[model samples]
Structures are given as C-alpha cells and as structure tokens.
Target: METFNLFHDATDVGPDGSEPEGYLCRAARLGPKLGASRLGMSVYDLPPGEAICPYHFEWTDEEWLVVVTGRPTLRTPEGEHRLEPGDVACFPAGPDGAHYVRNDDEAPARVAMVSTKNEFGIAEYPDSDKVGVWAGDAHYMLRRSGHLDYWEGER
Candidate 1:
C-alpha cells in the first residue's frame, strides 16, 4: 500500500517563475503521483500578492479547497473572504462555483484543492472573458468574445 500526505507530498504544478504573476503560485499536482484517475488534488503554496488563477468556474467538475496554513483570501460570486488554517470550502459545478484564491497577507500560505476528474472539461474565466477546454491530450484557451457562428466556416 502507498500513502501520501496532503500537507507534505507534492510535485511541481505551477507558477514556474513566468511573467504572468496572476497565476503564480508554488503549486504541486498530487493526483498523478498517487495514481489518481477519476479525482485530482492540487496543493499550492501562495505568497503575498500571488493567485492560483483568475476567477473561474468549471462546467463538469466539483471542487473543494482546504486551507492548510496561514490565511488566504477567497473570492467567489458572493464576495471575498479570508480563510484560516483548517478552513474548507466546496465549489459545485457551474456559475455558482466561480472562485479565485490568493494570499493577501505578508506571509505565505498553503492550500489544497481537490476535484472530480473528467475525460473532457470546460472551464471559463469570467474576469478575462475566456474559456478553457481540455480533452485527453488537446487543450484550448479562447476568448468568448470571438464568437463563431454555427456554420461560419463550413461549406
């Protein structure tokens, strides 16, 4: 039998010292390492002013976030709230689940996000007006403003 600790075990998953600070976070994807197929868990160590992602929602999966250390700010459709260690929140699939997490304090904080996995997934960024789709191996990120007609290019 194999076991992993949510607060300790993790593999690289984010930030990568990129120019876009909006998605910068010391994150690790643990699902793959633990042989997870239908579910996934991502752990993130967020520094001040860093966010996991822009406010978004999933169309096919439900997620839950657990604060492991320090306090992080969570933004949802309702409003922004500070989450302390041991705090947990559930985000159901759809618009009501739209959310964003960031560290607004002087110190760093850790958080774990667990969600259902799907063969294909669709996510939308309301703040950026973009949509993200993933299937097997191909993934696409596009702006919703670029609307296409049903037969725009079809003959």
Candidate 2:
C-alpha cells in the first residue's frame, strides 16, 4: 500500500497551461496512485485567486470536498462562502449541486475533491452556458445555446 500525506507528500502534477490561468493548480492524483477505481480523488494546492473548476453539476455523479489547509471560497447557488480546514461539503448530482471553488485567501489553499466516476456522464456549466459530455472514451464540451430539434438531423 502507498502512503500519501496531504501536508508533506509531493504532488505529481502542476501548472501545465492546459487549464485556463485562474483554474490552474498543483495536484496530487490520489485515486490512481492508491489503486482506487470507480471513485476518484485528488488533492489540490490552489494558488491565491485560482479555482478548481468552473461552476457546474453532473447529471448523475455525486461529489464531495474536504478542505485541508488555507481557507478557500465555495460558490453554490446560495452564493460564495469561505470554508475552513476539516470542512466537508457534498454536492449531489444535478442543478442543485452546481458549485465552484477558489482560493480567495492571500495564501495557498489545499482541498481534496472526491467524486464517483460514471462511465457515461453529462455535466452542465451554467456560468459559461455550456455542457460537457463524457463517455467511456469520448468527451465533448458544447455551448448551451446550440440546440436543435431531436429530429432535425434524422433522415
């Protein structure tokens, strides 16, 4: 078994420029390292003014967050709020679970995001008016306004 410490363990991933500037973070992908399947977990060291991801919700996967270090701000439908160390929050699947997390404090923040992984899933991003589709191997990010009738493309 592999032992990983949130406070002292070295992170395996860092700023890669793959994500937008404000969404970047140095992360330790714990799930794969610890042989976790079905469920996914990652510990992120978030820089001040940075975020974990956009405000969105999954169609069927539930997510949980655990704050380990500096205070980070959480934004849900209710509005933005600061979270403290040891704080845990659950985001059920769907619109009611829509949320976003950011390191609003002057110092860096650390948080763990644990979520159930579904082979097929859909996520909606309300802020950007976009939708993400994820299947076993296929993925897509599309605009919410680009909708068409169900039969529009049928012969």
- Scored by lDDT, the top model is 2
Cα displacement (angstroms), candidate 1, residue 64, comes to 0.7
lDDT of each: 0.89, 0.92
Which residue ranges in model 1 land beyond 4 Å of their true spot? none
Worst 10 residues of 2 by lDDT: 3-12
Candidate 1: residue 57 Cα off by (Å): 0.4
Determine the C-alpha RMSD for candidate 2 after optimal superposition of all C-alphas: 1.2
Clashes of each: 0, 0
> Alpha-carbon error at 41 in model 1, in Å?
0.2
The best candidate by TM-score is 2
